[model samples]
Target: MAAPYRSREGLSTRPGAYGGSSDEIQLRIDPMHGDFDEEVSGLRKQVRKLRDVAQEIETEAKFQNDFLNQLMEKVLMPTALRNELPD
Candidate 1:
């Protein structure tokens, strides 16, 4: 990427915006680092909770399907045989 404007002149020896000269630039820490970690941790917790709920729903569905199959075998099979056996 190109800069907004190219500087033909080299480094200049002048006073900086702060108390020091331009050669000595100050390093600063970003303020959002802690907030970023907190947000990630919260998101992880929500994902874990969602996974647990999905597993529970899957287990309940399997159980209900098995119960329905058993009920059909016990209740409907005899009725179907009786209908075919007589008027």
Candidate 2:
């Protein structure tokens, strides 16, 4: 059987291998960093879509409020004037 591998000062035994544990840690974390960046971009797009929807809804509500106010003014003005006139 081959000799059991021993790590000296957390270094890999293979020749030409660099910075054992720290290199391994970087290898593991690189892919996760890419995935995290992708997820953040996706979330930003979703937030932008939600913001656009909110703006559209706000604009429509304002238009409806203005329309209702104009309708009330048209309907009530003649009645108010007639009530003020004598019989």
Candidate 3:
């Protein structure tokens, strides 16, 4: 036979339940007034900073690629071409 079900105020009757007093469980239903605004502002600032950093990195990468290509064309290719010329 199964045990009968019981209902207690602010208490759980399930097996392996947290056996603490109801006062330990605190519930908050407050509205997000100022904290939400502050959090959104902080997130926007961080996103802007990250975007600026990404742009800088992209610019630096493009400059480095161009410099490397110029070096190959002006220095390495001429040397290679001279070696291929008839003596």
User: What are the lDDT figures for the candidates, one per model?
Assistant: 0.61, 0.61, 0.59
Candidate 2 root-mean-square deviation in Å: 19.8
lDDT of 1 by residue, 1-87 (tens): 232222222212434568663343222235654455654575577669979999999999999999999999999999989989956
- Candidate 2 per-residue lDDT, tens place, 1-87, comes to 122233222222333356444222111224533576664575577669979999999999999999999999999999999999999
Give the TM-score of each candidate: 0.56, 0.60, 0.57
Please tell me which model should have the higher lDDT, number 2 or number 3: 2
Off by over 4 Å in 2: 1-34
What does each candidate score in C-alpha RMSD? 20.4, 19.8, 17.8
lDDT of 3 by residue, 1-87 (tens): 122222222222333337643323221223543455654575577669979999999999999999999988998888999999999
- Candidate 1 clashing pairs, residues 3+ apart or interchain: none
Best by TM-score: 2
Please give the lDDT score at residue 87 for candidate 2. 97
Higher-ranked by TM-score: 2 or 3: 2
The candidate maximizing lDDT is 1
How many clashing residue pairs appear in each of the predictions shown?
0, 0, 0
| Candidate 3, backbone clash total | 0
lDDT of 3 at 79: 91
